[model samples]
Target: MAMFSTGGFAQHGKSKKVKNAPVFSQVVYQGDDKVYNEHPLKAGEFYNPILQGCYPDPAITRKGDDYFLVCSSFAMFPGVPIFHSKDLVNWTQIGHVLDRTSQLKVHDTGISAGVYAPAIKYNPNNDTFYMITTQFAGDFGNIIVKTKDPFKGWSDPVKLNFEGIDPSIFFDDDGKAYVVHNDAPNRGEALYEGHRVIKIWEYDVENDQVIAGTDRIIVNGGVDLAKKPIWIEAPHLYKKDGRYYLMCAEGGTGGWHSEVIFVSDTPKGPYKPAPSNPILSQRYLNPDRANKVDWAGHADLVETPDGKYYGVFLAIRPNEKGRVNMGRETFILPVDWSGEFPVFENGLIPMEPKLNMPEGVENKTGKEGYFPNGNFTFTENFTSPQLDYRWIGLRGPREEFASVLKEGGLQITPFPVTIKEVKPTSTLFHRQQHNNFSFTTTLKYVPKSEKDLAGITCAQSERFNYVFGVTKKDKDFYLVLERTERGTSRVLASTKVELKEPIRLQVKGIGDDYEFSYSTGGDRFVRLGGIVSGDILSTNVAGGFTGCLLGLYATSANDILVE
Candidate 1:
């Protein structure tokens, strides 16, 4: 983990002007949510969202006493974040399944168009683990990766011949395998706007490909097509008591989202919709309920070693303005499978923030090596050579533009690309995990021109974001704030600054309101834009599948116009 800083800053002939790279000494993020403060966690109680902040479309699999879970990572480099846990409550991120650039080829794609709904399953037949997913970019649709050991690494992706999304692999008891995915109805036979079908194919596990001419339609148009369910996707297959079961997400991934189930006698057949469809949902609950959790669907079920069942699904917690800024997160609920169909216990009702811990399982979250859940504070001083897994780059590898300096700091070589472009920029990003939080960073940078800017950016996508940085205006230096919404850009505030030493920048989110401030060699921070609406950074307004990203941005092509 040696630093990558060697060449000095000098102008190359006919190339873009190179300025002194920005050095970020430290970054601090503190989460202080009121919901957690009011309804504090009691003994033997844990939070509903096991993993927060844009970790959606959860799929879990159990191998022996170890459980492995994965989630969708759209356009983020090192796609398909994989986590491991011994007890279902305590989890730790091992590493990404697609860490190499050869496996993740989303460098030219949009922020929301890469990996989607990754399914990780362990095949006891061969003592191997397979991760199947859809890459919306690079024309690499429906691919699978495998590894004998998930703790070490995974193999490069082998593209599967498929024309659909949300592909999952199921291993049968008879040493056979099948792939289930969501696709369009038969050619020209689509009846409604959201009409979709679930198709299954016999998979050749040895060769890692689907057998030709073996595809069959399993569930058409979701449960009860007469009612017209929209977006019947994220299908998973399981076998219990010698019966094959198919489960899917219906009614899109919004407020009407839900999980439905169907049963069949064989691997592929005329599957019968469960009489108790929508085994899990929160759509019918009161929207104004305190600490509300909505859009609960896209679930995958796993059995505990002690014969208990639990489901991992995606849900959201909107701010007071009814806007989704944190994006969809992962939540777990006990499943009651004593009946004909498994149902999420108390999932149909308004969800509570706390859940009773399993018998003899201590809540080790945020401690030892387990991933944190509740309120916490994280600080990074860039002293270590190895970057934490929490820091990620969009559409490209972080090592390409970022390097740890020998003098103990992070040096970001300014990329010619701006944040508004679909191309990968020199910005290190961390997901905005809480609605009420504060993020601050210490920066040592001085802009050479208006085209040179370095500071922080809160981005939802290429079209919607806020740029707050230090730039030179004529002969004077200034701190500027710019907001971009729906591809349009406007400056919110700008102030003159006398930069004699390293400055500090901070952004605080109070419910739906966000404040941007700066400090110059002092403890007092001056608010720049007063209190501005965080609507532009929300998925409701941004219209993407990602949460807000707090980015350490630097660009030689800075375009925030200042008057």
Candidate 2:
């Protein structure tokens, strides 16, 4: 298997000045299988984020007792990660929808410029799962794929001629299927910056083609003509109590983000806005200084077996500077439907981390809780035949450059793609799930040239990153600490070291700061430099839709694809 890079970075013109922030780290999964807050498990109680770390735009569907869900992967190669849940609380990753390169084509994508929002739905009639998503700014526009067994593999993509982002498929009760998406306007000119319309098209799922003449606008701009919200996206269609409900995210995806509902008598007709418009939003709520789960919207609903309704939506946890480095994570909350429409809460949704699980659902997974119990540990021994499922690549697959050593450890071949470019960078990374954690890795190879380097990195994107690399200059070895804030990169510290011995690199994350250190042979690591502010790598600072990635990488400026 080859190595790959993951996560987005701060880009030009979109970069925000880094702010001085305090240290804060939320305890997620420890090393052991137990939640950090070890409250006794009950029948109707669980934590939020069934899936964690840059897992956004959650689309969940249930088949009998088994629940299957998926999330958007952006530029990551294995796009759309799918998970299985016996009860919505405990979820295990089954596989990826676009696991093979043939199913997905990604190359030289900018930060958050690949696959946008993915809608995964199961068709009971054919017993197959269909996943439709948009390849934003990619070679293909909208694409679809399916699989009988989600764990094994999915078929190649069926490219759709839809010109929009966040495409979703809705299979009506009458067996007719339709796709609702944020349709682009005509080519000439626009009155506003983000003026886009929502449209629905008659789709032929069996033949994997859309009917030509059946396209029509369902929503002109967005609800509340007075406010005139722009960027009406993340559209999902549903039927509730004989009324067709069309839910979409409006007012862009930042602070003003919100979920609005539209109801219509017919599947495709004049739709009216619900009285309780902007049903779920944190814009009015006080800034959550504690968890920072603000910017709540872009949701998908799923009804449980016991007739309980729950909505999985996207939310962010920002740092002290209001800069979100964790990206948009998936959050689940129960929907109370006692009134005319389904309500997530009485008013705007609250940051309810501890929620009551769906009724009649017991913990059948036999696990203690959703997260592990230790302080936060990810030690890849490199003993497995395949790389860990959590490991991700930049724009390509693991077969591109990195491989696991037979005896132990990992061997990352130096690729010609420099860390400066977003495309073709050779790196293998996992989500920096915890706010505070320590990452340590031992390097077995020595750099032969100034351009050839290998070590660990905490990256917001290819253009914005913090790298702790091993390098050589003038036949002397050195440990280097480099920081790439937006488009600017510079070395913070470097020291000469003996090249005969293996090197150990360490990066300790404390809230919005990262401390880098390294050792020559033993565990006697020395600090490389002062604490590096992490806000430079935040989505707010970096201006991307992804969180930070903690992983290993190797760079060869010569474009060589080998060691």
TM-score against native, each model: 0.96, 0.89
The local lDDT score (0 to 100) that residue 375 gets in candidate 1 is 86
Query: Which prediction has the highest lDDT against the true structure?
Result: 1
TM-score of model 1 vs. true structure: 0.96
Off by over 4 Å in 2: 1-44, 186-190, 346-349, 360-375, 558-563
- Model 2 gets an lDDT of 0.72
RMSD of each: 3.9, 7.8
Clashing pairs in 1: none
Estimate the lDDT of model 1: 0.89
Among all windows of 10 consecutive residues in model 2, the one with the lowest summed lDDT is: 20-29
